[model samples]
Target: MKNKEKIGFMCAYTPLALIDAAGYAPYRILPSEACEDRAGHLLHDNLCPNIKKILDRALAGDVPDLAGVVFVNSCDAMRRLADAWQHVRKDDRIIWIDLPSSIDAMAHAYVQGQVEQMGRTLLSWSGSPMDPMAVEKSITSFNRICAHLSELAPAFASGAIPGGYAAMQALYNKASTRDFTTTLEEIEPMPGKTPAPKHDAVPVYLFGNVLPDPKAFDMFESCGAMIADADFCTGSRLFSPVTGGQKDVYSRLTSHLMTKPQCARSFDPALPGEIAKTTLSRARAVNAAGVIGHVIKFCDPYLERLPGIREHFKKNNMPLLILEGDCTLRSMGQQRTRIEAFIEMLM
Candidate 1:
């Protein structure tokens, strides 16, 4: 088996365990500032900037060599991204997974079947057979990675790890390509350095769409605030641990997916207030003084969820700042005044 092959995925819904099981490195296609105008010409300007930046990279052939790319139907924009990729990169093998929007018994079965199918597809792509042991081993490795990240969370929140922005960058970088052990070795604090003394910087929880640039966090910190925690798909959401210890690989994957952080794309009619509750719980966990929601322009799901979020924060007397951007450092820089003002308000 050629272990050098790589498989790319865009959403958190993609099962990294299955990708690893198929003897391919899992690569996350994060947002970048490259080719936004070109992508805007292909995709509508009204689309979310996160999807647009990803398509921009794909169009520019900026991605790493991959055996295939997997796209999950987490939202309409992502589905359209897959469609656009098909037209642009016809030679690349593209797989689309229809993720269930809700969480329930039927939804669980549907997602489990999708994951199993993805595993079969990966095996075919890799010219390998289904290996249950490989799948379980991958699960254990990923869980270890999560455990390592969990250990760093307290240090990160308390300003001991240099800065939260750098920590978040290290996290996304490690998860995208490196294995658990390599990631641990790379991020472990150097010897003989005392933890940075905690400050009275306004503790803030960052929420919303993909913040690809760590500079965004720097901007938050520069404005006299500290990022205590993040509720981003590419950040803390991706590091959620797998539980249940299910023997079946697909069952284990599904169980983990069902309990992970709730994105705007994941809807449960039975729990309308789930996202707000999750956000609140995370904020309170770090004793956050405020919440900042930095979403890309034209992200409908998040825009729709904003009213409820506002109401929740208002009821609790927690300050909430919603800033829309185009998913670039330039755009984020433009919001500095607003962010600084928000932080001043919190202070």
Candidate 2:
């Protein structure tokens, strides 16, 4: 244990937990919290909003004790962002891991290789291999966390929990890297805040990248839309359970991440439909009216697949409103009006 140096880690969903397990304080790039506007000037509008926001954060130098930054090529935007990071953080070691976009055995093996490579990079940078015992413990902890989150999502949907309030708490859990057991102990059910069975709002399933502003959520709720479920990598998709109970913790960790629905960069041929089904099922289970998809500008993967997803929803007669923006509150006013109108039509 070499004094537990704090490393600034940024990547798509699955890799965050791994870096944390490797004894680094894994930092997910939350561009909404950034101090400066580096991304607003350089990157074109076609680049992924999340990437742009992250680049802006990097430029602001808000990450004070960052040892290095990790980049996972989970999507094309990330690949280019890694190049940008290389240019900006010339002094920091940039570990770029190529992530596969499927859940098959070959995809698992591909991700496993990436995990092993990340381990070597960590050893070279920190002069330490992730402790085998710690890796195992982390796996168990992550599994528990995933299970608890799964429970939370449904409970939040069923009026057993207040969804907005629970989201606020979960965001804290993610930012602090709290282990599952500790988080569970801290999140006691709100005594009087338990949701009453109310049916005034139209249930909605939301999809897309991390919204930099909380106002986007407020906008949706203002339109009488209750976000019953979501498939965004930063949202519910990021918390799916990692398959555990394996002898090789390293391989299992990679495999678990590769299989989970949380990885947005994954391009499995079946995944788009799988996600559609899952989102629809959850929505139907909760009696949702439609879906409000926030399509981040320049996110090629989500953009490319949007047409097909829209078609699928149409087949099921599930109305979907696709809003394009960079997830900044300032840039999203027009989108808010459109959503408000869409919700009005739904009524």
Q: Write the per-residue lDDT of candidate 1 for residues 51-129, one digit (tens) a residue.
A: 8888988888888888999998888898788888888888889877777778888888998888898999999988888
Report, for every candidate in turn, its global Cα lDDT versus the true structure.
0.79, 0.66
lDDT of 1 at 315: 89
TM-score of each prediction: 0.93, 0.84
Over 104-153, each residue of candidate 2 has an lDDT whose tens digit, in order, gives 87877777887877766776776666576766766666556556665565
lDDT of 2 at 285: 79
Number of clashes recorded per candidate: 0, 3
Q: Give candidate 1's root-mean-square deviation (CA, Å).
A: 2.3
